[model samples]
Target: MNQEFYHELGHVVLHIGNQRQMTDSFRRYKESKANHFMYHACVPTFMI
Candidate 1:
């Protein structure tokens, strides 16, 4: 529904883990993936 919800959903869909124990680069990478997913989730291709 909201951007925050999709962002969190991205993490779930991507199977991302806790960032507390992740390296900086790895954390950024995961965050990037989640962000990408968020965008797609927020605006589905079917709607486009």
Candidate 2:
């Protein structure tokens, strides 16, 4: 649940507008970035 929250938060923080008009590739890129963010947010470098 906490990871999910950070994933969405990554979207809100990194993306600032509607995503309905984005291209498929760009959407995938954004999702990838969010996933990266979620991973880092959930597990900081110091904890690794």
Candidate 3:
């Protein structure tokens, strides 16, 4: 889906090379943030 694509893109934009060095917990945390970024990036405030 588009949302998942953007979420993964978020990781590329913000995390990039840092991901390989992350712990499982931290990776999950960052993934959550990336999802949040995708939601905000794709959704408009008027639609919320």
Predicted structure with the largest TM-score when compared to the true one:
2
Residue-level lDDT for 24 in candidate 2: 88
For model 3, residues 1-48, the per-residue Cα lDDT tens digits are 889899988888877557678799999988898999898888967998
Q: Between the candidate structures 2 and 3, which one is better when assessed by lDDT?
A: 2
- State in Å the error of residue 7, model 1: 0.5
- Backbone atom clashes (below 3 Å) for every candidate: 0, 0, 0
Q: lDDT value for candidate 1?
A: 0.83
Q: For each candidate, give its TM-score against the true structure.
A: 0.76, 0.84, 0.70
Query: Residue by residue across 6-48, what tens digits does model 2's lDDT show?
Result: 9999999998666898898999999999999999899867888
Best by lDDT: 2
What Cα-based lDDT does every candidate model obtain? 0.83, 0.90, 0.86
Runs of candidate 2 with Cα error greater than 4 angstroms are 44-48
Residue pairs with backbone overlap in model 2:
none
TM-score of 3: 0.70
Model 3, residue 45: displacement in angstroms? Answer: 7.6
Position 43, candidate 3: lDDT: 92
Q: Looking at model 1, report the run of 10 residues with the lowest lDDT sum.
A: 10-19
Between prediction 1 and prediction 2, which has the larger lDDT?
A: 2
